[model samples]
Target: MTRRLLALSILLCPLLAACSLEPLINHQVVDYFEANDIASNQVILQNILRAKDGAPLHFSELASIRGSLSNGASVSTTFPFMAPDHATTLPRKLGTVGMTITSSPSFDIDSLDTQDFTNGVMRPITPETAQFFLNEGIDYRMVLLLLVSGLRSGGRPEMLLNAPNSSRVVCYHELPALNALPTQYSILEADEPCDGQSEPEFYAFLRTINHLGRLYPLSVPQPPKPVGRPFDLDMTKALTAVASIDPGRYSLARLASGQYQLMSAAHGSYVILCRETPDGPAVAGVLTSERDESTPVPVDACSRKHGNAADQHASGDPAGAAQPMMMIGEQKNTVVFKLRSTLEVIQYVGQILALQQDETEANPQLPERCVTLEYENYKGGNMTCNFGVLFHLQRAGPAFSSPLNAVSYNGVSWSLPAPKVCRAPTRCDHTLETISVISLLLNQNKSSKDIAKTQAVQVVP
Candidate 1:
């Protein structure tokens, strides 16, 4: 028996020696990190819930987590070489083999529930930030509809076309005429009707964000970085400089042979998406036909040069003139559009949630602003819905879908459906991408990844 026990210990020594806990420890740490991410998403959703319930929004952040794991193994064996030949009590063998593992994890949490943090989150987003997100490749509709409060024409904030109820229906057929209307049209004589409420135009704006975005994207047209010193630039200089490049492009000066060369610069704000014509370059209202696919000409400025119908034009103000038009505002000028802050945007989502919850199958308090969306009952049809439709939260039964994000609030689970499973509010898998993108947007920072790197756990291998 003594020899057997010694042999068993010897045999187990190699097994114990080959087992290194580093990989296991690393995996534990990574799991902890993923837990924090999951919790963070829950926090974002919970705050959105607060907004929905009209409760003031609050936030908390996981500062860090420290975890330790301890492992122990035991082995034992016993055998009676032979049953007791004469013993009344059996000499049958009993052996034990056992292993034990234990873990303890600690967390450091921080609260952003303070006044300063709340204020920062609630502060209006700047034009620079709006432009930055646009550059980030967020869907143009998301950028415009969520962040933008409304158009700023003639220095007045006009939310002439903003309405939707979690239902993201768009009127693609109507966008061209909608985009063609001057920015000042909201303030001007109002030919197309600016009653501060128009269902068709709202859906039109939401429907065709792709071309509409290109036709009327936000711009912070910075003056070209001077190669040397700045020079007084005129309308003619702007036009002449860009002459050699293309009609729908901007102009800049490049150093050449000890002199500045006038040429078209790709960095222009408004571009006239035009189609070639025998009569001349007619201004295209929007990218509608195959002919409208012509290379868009960049318009440097909206200068008045009335003459032949050869000049290109763009999507706003006095839309056409003999020279290329900047086409930014009510009077053919650029203006700083407004963007909502993080808190405000979340509040809007809350409002939509509250509305969706309160709305009924019988009465259905949906506004006329959702007219275009009402055309939805058809499948295998054109895409009339907006990204919001892709962002769905279920008050019940999210567990079945394996929700992408979910949280326990007031003893109930609120979940945004896994894009992989519950495709859209329609509860079918269409595309499984945008809901994750929603999380990405919420976690956006002026510098997100860099800040994450600074916060990363330093694992010295």
Candidate 2:
């Protein structure tokens, strides 16, 4: 009986080795990825197998078996010792294994269009393209998942991928390079601005690719919905108010009721008050000389034609030459300019303040109903007069309030409910004018540096 059993074991050994060869090969591949700390590669292999065969083979399951075998706790480890003849049989079976592997498929990496995987530029991967990568032994599914994660995470793939050129495969070799780079992927967090890309636009593009369902088999998670603003203020009035003032000379704040508050750029300067009147929302304040004494006002030739005191003075008219005087008390107490409509204010202020002196020369007629000032004289007597009496506040034309449409000025479109202020009132410590000046200086400096760098590069050649 013992001789018969030994003879039977010899015959059955080769068959048993053949049966165990496939699992051993799979275990070795899983061990290689895990030992090398290549989790991405391991995932790719599992995914490929899952795609080819309907069975889901997890690396963790293989890892657990490997752990048991290494600790001498698994019964399968003794199979090799029980049948030494199986080892001789394995060498002959390798050819069959190689044939099976080669028969799976070979991918043409060179055939893939270089443009499809370029960083920053999003393009859909065709089903054929994905299959080609898979055939090349590239885990295209893993590649797609990592790509979507990097993009959604807000990391610039250009920075991460570091391909030699736009037209190149973002390879498995390149995947390890990301570990050295900063993990941040969101465009918003990047110091350099992306071409006005928002998070929503990026996710929308991802969703488009996901719907194609060729690159990645699984569905990508949807991005969170953006929060909406609670209220929309009439930005026309605020924007008009801001544009009318010399940019650095004034600051604006939106009130809770959607009205705006204007204040002088000077620290501790009182708010430029606005009142709701029967005429409309009118600004109640006095236009006082910034200086205590009269200074040499630079009046242009066109302004002199307006016959205002400042213009006369500049043109050598004796009456104009007489130093423009103001009541000491009334100097501090200016007039109320009524708000007709936010758009109309710009036209009204432009004419009344001689901002459009050229237009004043063409048709010089002061409006009868221009801005009015009401204040007490030096003798403490109440008085009221048009701002035109003191300064050349010319009228442009009929009020612009009639045909209400969008107002475009200085390259900004001021819509009815003003676009939300870029900075909240509490955060806007610096006057808009000051911020504009700083921004201009910074931009000019950047432009100068860029020019200098370009010149240097050219000169080096």
Candidate 3:
């Protein structure tokens, strides 16, 4: 009976070791995760490049991954204490155990040519997503440029202020008498006394919208409180009042009189551009940063936090140009801009890539291009380009290349420029930061049938 019990225990050792294979294969699992992430980024870059070339856009997903793993286990029983302790029940040393886990994982990648993919990509963004980004303190300019498809307001085509003898623009034309905003993605910058050379249509529009953050501030509230009547909402009209106007986003209330009322469910939400002050009490107050037009503006990046009380004290247009009232009040304000679809964003980014490439080729050794503002009243130019700084996807020869962010397409490596700080893996690069936000938008627009990736790991014995 004693011998039988000892033999049973020895056999159990092998089974126990086999069941604990998980701890040994953790590295392999992480490898798979990283691979998928890199692939997703590459696909996005490829589409953007295609957009620049006027080629067809395509998408592919790593649908599923299956791994066939082989496990090898060896258990060798030794004497209880070598040759001298063989007779004793307690051995001087334990038996040797070892294991080797090898896996050949096969991934099933499917091209996104299906109608479902097209429909999902073409779907417009909702107000909720925009609101979420605003509340998160994302730059107002970045949000508007990426999401807004078209603006509905009265303004002159934006004008670019230029240096005295040079053609490059130094700032935006904020003089109401000199400029009004364009209603759509502009083909050219507003011709001014300065050099009239405009950037690509999209970049010009990008810079045009950059000024919108300073010229127009907004607040998105659950039960919106309008300051005045730039727009009106009612059963007869679709304009946004202090209520929900779109029936698709929120179910309109049906009155007892059997008429559809322009209203929302208790929790329904919507967007408001130039409606009210983005921060602080909605009453009388100027944003801490509002300034005079005599200062030159930094035209590159308008990345100041949109509505943070802490950041309020450190305010001025990146370009030192003058700004209009931050909040709307029965003014000729741009009420709303149509939000773009996922497909449109991809195309937008692609066009941007083309512009950047043109710039780099023109000055290969160009030490980070700086957008400037040459105000007529200001003596020196405010040279800054956070907008361009955030988007430096180095041409053919990648800048700040790493295995994590690099992609080999057509035998050339491509990657985003590195971030100045490296405190964490997330939010390390502006390129990655923008891409992740867009990716989140894509996820929000997914169809119900979209099978989100699974976290389960299967092992066949």
Candidate No. with top lDDT: 3
Score residue 241 of candidate 2 by CA lDDT: 49
Instruction: Report the lDDT tens digits of candidate 3 across residue range 431-450.
Output: 66568776776656556444
Error of 3 at 454 (Å): 4.7
lDDT of 2 by residue, 346-365 (tens): 12223322322332344434
**What are the RMSD figures for all models against the true structure?**
11.2, 35.0, 12.9
Off by over 4 Å in 1: 1-18, 71-101, 114-116, 126-138, 153-221, 224-298, 301-327, 332-336, 358-390, 398-404, 421-438, 445-461
Ranking by TM-score: 3, 1, 2
- Give candidate 1's whole-model lDDT: 0.45
Q: Model 2 — TM-score against the truth? A: 0.14
Instruction: List, residue by residue over 204-299, the lDDT tens digit for candidate 1.
Output: 344334233242333323222223342455556566654555534434442222234333333533222222335544333221111112122224
Cα TM-score of candidate 1: 0.54
Poorest 10 consecutive residues of model 1 by lDDT?
285-294
Q: Which ten residues in a row have the lowest lDDT in candidate 2?
A: 452-461
Which has the greatest TM-score? Answer: 3
CA lDDT scores, all candidates in order: 0.45, 0.26, 0.47
* lDDT accuracy of residue 63 in candidate 2: 23
